[model samples]
Target: MSRPHRPGSGIRSAWWCEFSTRTPAFGDGDERVLLRAQSAETPTQVMVWIRLAVRVLLSGFDPRDTERAYHWLDHGQWEAVARLADGEPYAFTAAAGRTHVEWSARPVLFLPLAHTATGPLGRCAEPALCACTARGHRCGGHRR
Candidate 1:
């Protein structure tokens, strides 16, 4: 089973995406961070999460570039959108709220869980006992 998303104290993920392609050979690399919040106390909204995810995945370009984004989840795989050469951020947001030509691109957040991994809470997805998850206590098991 997967770890239950705790919300307030969620996981943080960061990755570098080479967004700009002005040089082709040396793209403008940027860092995209997503503080995955599973708890109700999370401050970031779903759209913000999606936007940040999109921003990281679709880094680079301006908010006025004309390149269109082409992404779709087909057959369990998230296909990559067409490279937005000088693409803009608004394009993706605008791509939503409308059904265009063949590609009816919309921002419907679909968070599919991956296979479970070893968690801090021994035998459980919860954090280990004590303050190990934060204060650095040598916790054992999922509870104190």
Candidate 2:
């Protein structure tokens, strides 16, 4: 079930859409807590969180964000990220018959989630592509 709309709730919704890839991973209790926290956050705070999560994912240091993202992102969305990471050309250095992988730093790009018939909080069959344009409707994009 979708939550009731409140002032600034769109920001929270948009954050979920962008960060979670529109997959609702949270349980009812977790959703309540996260929504409350997100509702209290400013736009700048949300952006900072997104940046930190992306940085953590790219660095491959912490698995927490990755785990969360796996739960939050649908299969196609996760596969897209995996493909991007896998396609990255990394250098390998060999020393003493041992090979070490060195990953090159790549710029992370934030792409907006495509709108679906179920909206941001709903389950979509095709999570990677936008249905709004295909349905001949204009999407307002993300809410400010």
Best by lDDT: 2
What local distance difference test score does each model get?
0.28, 0.32
RMSD of each: 15.9, 19.2
lDDT of 2 by residue, 19-94 (tens): 2212234554212111111210233333344444444444352355445444443332344334334533221111
* Model 1, residue pairs in steric clash: 7-38, 7-39, 62-88
Query: Which pairs of residues collide in candidate 2?
Result: none
> After superposition, which runs of candidate 2 have C-alpha atoms over 4 Å from their true positions?
1-18, 21-37, 60-144
Tens-digit per-residue lDDT, 28-125, candidate 1 = 54333222222211222322433444545433433332133323222111222222112211122322212111111222223334454753323444
**Which run of 10 residues does model 1 get worst, by summed lDDT?**
15-24
